[model samples]
Target: MNGLDEAVAASGSDVISASAGSLRERFEAAFMPNYGVPPLVPVRGEGCHVWDADGRRYLDLIAGIAVSSLGHGHPALVEAVSRQVATLAHTSNLFVNEPEVLLAERLLGLLKAPGRVFLANSGTEANECALKLAIKHGTATGRTYFVAAENGFHGRTLGALSLTGKPSIRDQFGPFPLDVRFVPYGDADALRQAVTEDCAAVFLEPTQGEAGVVPPPAGYFAAAREICDATGALLVLDEIQSAIGRTGHWFAHQHDGITPDVLTLAKGLGGGMPIGACVGFGESGTIFAKGDHGSTFGGNPVSSAAALAVLDTIERDGLLENVRTVGARLAAAVDAVDHPLLARVRGRGLWLAAVLTTDAAAAVQAEAQRAGFLVNAVQPDAVRIAPPLVITAEQADSFVAALPGILTEASA
Candidate 1:
């Protein structure tokens, strides 16, 4: 049997037993249907690999939807979390903690811009905070409307969902906050027309992650910055999936040589622990007055320490350079394959997607899982590949080498 066949055969029994049900039963009984039913119940993970309940190993490329920056079980992350947990876990927003202050400082330093940060527990919360800040900042001038880009995803909270451009998800969740307009992404002219003096903010992603890693044209952000400046609107860039070294930079917008008035970050910020931040620059940073907004569990000691460790480890181990080098290597290798089924590669650094010629992304994802790899079919024709930063070039090449067979099986 070929490698793919052997892989499937070897895991067949485990798959059958898992489907017959123990974990799935327990999961279905307790969990909400929001995530649907997960196919694999992972027992443990280390480095770039995770093992299912049946003890079958799969190369984890999705990295918890781009949350696991240091991969699974890095010593630094574990040590930091454990130490902070033992010392103090939650202090709430009523009190300040060292880790929280330090993390905020470090983030601002990385941005190299004068800013203040509001911490939160998730990306949605961060975006919500940014939205609130934008509105509050605009209240002085009677600005009300918020402009976002089509196909851009900010988050799923009511406010953030209002800013999201995907109608399929947002349509069902509305009576969302009104006065949100969307222009086609990467169209500077559309944005210029959309952002009037009445606009409160214009939110965008450096690259649309949930829209299957669609990167905007070069200078798109720069032009948006100019438009927002001319219109006196805050430029809020949602870096939830594109920040924290995902694109070989502290923030993806930094690559465009532009600074946004507001920036939101979450995924990969705490390595795996949930944490998010809404950072506002210059006068925008000071818009949130007392009692403006707060989070009960935001910037908890444990999550803050974990985030600090993630930052320290990334700097100490030079993972940023690794991401740039290995990411380029992987992208080049995949493009060089020139498979008939493959359309093109999109995204930068470790965050990437392989566009397929056919609407077989879901099948390709399933085939990849069967072949002992984990990936995400973000769209009908796009397979998102965002492995942990710890993933080596060799590991990436392994996935690239398997693409042709995986696509062939998916087509069948």
Candidate 2:
């Protein structure tokens, strides 16, 4: 036998066996190395819990990087996707579908504003659509420059990656589309200085999710709106990670009582199905004419149906209110622990981060995994926690209770 076959035969009985090391070896041999080595092989999931290939269950706090809004294996999601796929799966963009129309209307109603929606298959595609709209909107006025905030993450596509401020991810991919300037996040004064009549759009996030859930300063969005209005630049909010009840609201910007000219959404929008939206408000909605943009699998019936089910379940089950209450309890519990290794807790609703006093977040994450929990060390000193919106106060408290021990062990 060849070396690879010999190794496989020596390692296990079957390829799908519950050995993470063997699975990881096979994965590395087969897939590209972009994601590096995955630490766990999750075989099944339900609600706020997931079971690994080894049959080890973990309290899933990250929830697929805040994408699993209704959590895993939700019956509503299953039913909607199953029903839609069985009925009519794909008609491309040539013909419209009921689920697509219904989802668009529902999204607009939730925004409580008049707008037009362009559906896509992911957050990056949604941002690409929004950027195209912004550029087109500026065409009538000769505005071509775009502004975004440093430390803000939009997406990884060429257009969206240009708007992202992290140099580590961006520096390697240039020469990108030009004329994009980045200002400090939460610094309205800097944003005011940067925006001008020549600027086409200013992209930002209500809270910097990938930047360890850092929230903006108070009244920052209000100030940003005023500045954009004065400068005649479109204000676009990237709500991909913070929207769809992840932040205890339909959209995180609602907390600031400001309406952006354009909004991009994805992540938890479809519970687990891939879907995204670029919504334009008022005059901004009319910027796109025919042939400006299009996507083949943009708003397919199955994904739209899944999104509809997620929205319905969130409302029917009162998951938004649950997020608010349980999120507060979780944050407060972290504060109550007051561990010496913990610096502070940042973020809102179920989306939170335990900022560490030392750069031991990776160790803490490893320790937490060993303790039967899943958390993300988003930075050297920050561990992000975004449980499913349906997570209970009791479940949150369980994590909170385990955190002190986890931190203690990590520190040691």
Candidate 3:
């Protein structure tokens, strides 16, 4: 038997093939319908491109929702994961691990702030950790309310969802445990009004990723810092989709010249491996004493090694500068498309969204896929482009050049 057949037989499963229909059918049967049915079944990837089960190749612009920082099959990530797994694959919080400690130290060093790190498996978990810490701090200070921005997204878990401002998903979840106040995103005055002494924490995304890569207005974050300081509220910046060179800086809040008391990171940190971190600064860091929180697979060696490799590669390749230069070029080229369907572009660095004149972003996304490129319709009128940080000038230009035609096809 061949390798595929051997694996299937060993698992005692029915035969499977690389055909898209078969794989998708199996996927639906074996998995929950939360994400619905995926449009394409990608079988292989390399650099900035991925091949579907049917053997069609396309430029991967979304990069797994901005998680694949160094793109697919990066040698450094592969080597590190392989070496670490071979040496030591996992060590629960019961024992110490080198990669986990190093990863925490490296992240704190990048922030240039004193803090303690809580490792987790996903962005939602990271936010959950932040939420717990905030609540502990608030409870100690006799605060009961939390503040977030409308149209902002944190995560879907109970604690994180409580801070999420998107009504569509949050409302269905019903009354959350935390009392949260919603404010208009990018409105400093509104934020100031919402965040008072009663507020325990203010959760904000430096750039709203799910709201179509929307960036806050200039001076907004700086004003937020002042407000939080005045109110004695903790500022929590969720950079799950914007950190690790997805933006031009190490962290998106840095662009606004402000530092959040608590920060959450994931997505791009592990370069496709599952990992997340919640960092609490100053007194907030001390709220969680021993036995306050823990995780089993949170900081396993494989994922920590992968995160380290991603960080190392980002610095070694100068991907931060690359993101700035190429992102500017892509934004300008997208705006210069001269297509009537094109409205404008939003976001900074590699995280960008093309806002369409009409609510045809889904159609445009489909057309881009047909034309050998992958993009995300983050909203009815916004197509998101968050390619690998290593995407080149030519690669970005190719997408821009094809966008006009794609928009025309989508409009038709």
Candidate 4:
């Protein structure tokens, strides 16, 4: 047998038969230490729950950090992925594909504007494309600086990280190539002061997802739009975590009744299938000419198909209406839970954070796992809950019923 064949033969059986402990041990030995070993080995999933290797079921509240919009094993998502992969999975930018074009059209339609889209494989990649677009626009306009919101997360790639406002993660990568200025989030005055005539773009999230689900003040985006318009800066909204009906809107910026020059989207766009889009409205859309930038798998049929499925499902199932009513109910219920450890809930629609009275988010997360619930410790003092868009009122009620007890146990 060939070398590759022999290697696969040697390890395939072991991998198939390994239990959770054994799998984790192998993972520690074989994989890079970047993420460390994950706590649970999820073997299967259905609806809003996942079964670990030990067959323990847990109600998934975070939905893969807000990626799985339709939840686990969604038939629409599954069928779209299966059909696309089987038909035409990978077509390089050398040729155009139907799903990619349709997705771009659909995204622009949702935005209620004319635009061009550049598809990528993740949020960072989408932001990277935006960065290049901004740079190109800068080069043409003789702009030198960029402005972004403090505590806002754009992405992890070097250029995108430069735009990100979190110091803890951005500082280590140190001295980024771009000249990006940071202003306090939701502070339109500071944003106006920072985004001068020479600024190329202004990057901001409608709601800061990584900063424990913090939404901007009322009319924040309108002020930003005005600032960018007067200063000739491109307003780039990174809706990586808030788009695709997460906040009861196609794009979170829609709530503000303003549109961004450039909008970056991912996460829920693909329903866990890994797709991102960098859409530019009007002139910004056509900034990247013939050979400015490209990704080998950027607009591949499979990912595009998956994205279309997510969009279609969201529309067909009336998930936006569901998000508005159910999300409000869920937030009210969680807020009403009388507990000393709980402070308040932040964010809009299904994206929420249970602020704590103390730094017990980690303990609460752990306790929640033991109680058959999965939540995210987005911060030391915040527990993030961004469940699937398809999560029913009944499923959310289950978590609400168990939360007080979970908090009590965590306090101990």
What is the C-alpha local distance difference test score of each model? 0.91, 0.92, 0.92, 0.92
In terms of lDDT, the poorest run of 10 residues in model 2 is 1-10
Candidate 4 per-residue lDDT over residues 275-382, each given as its tens digit: 889999999999988999999999989999999999999999999999998899999999999999999998899999999999999999999999999999999999
* Candidate 2, pairs of clashing residues: none
Task: Give a tens-digit lDDT track for model 1, residues 1-412.
Answer: 5543465567766544464258788778899988887888876688999878777899999999999999998999999999999999889888989999999999999999999999999999999999999888778889989899888888888899999999999999788666999999999999999899999999999999999999889989999999988989999999999999999997899889999999999989999999999999999999978998989999999999999999999999999999999999988888787778899898999999999998989999999999999999998999999999989988998898888899888888
Please identify model 2 stretches exceeding 4 Å from their true place. 1-18
Q: Candidate 4: minimum summed lDDT over ten consecutive residues — where?
A: 1-10
Candidate 4: lDDT of 196?
Answer: 88
Q: Name the runs in model 3 displaced over 4 angstroms.
A: 1-16
lDDT tens per residue, model 3, 1-412: 6554366557753333458898888889999999888899886678998988777999999999999999998999989999999999988999999999999999999999999899999999999999998899899999999999999999998888888888999999979878999999999999999888999999999999998899999899999999999999999999999999888999999998887999999999999999999998988788888999999999988999999999999999999999999999999999888889999998999999999999999999999999999999999999999999999999999988888899999999
Residue 250, model 3: lDDT of: 92
For candidate 3, what is the total of clashing residue pairs? 0
- Stretches of candidate 1 exceeding 4 Å from the true structure: 1-20
lDDT for each residue of candidate 2 in 341-388, tens digit (9 for 90 to 100) = 998898899999999999999999999999999999999999999998
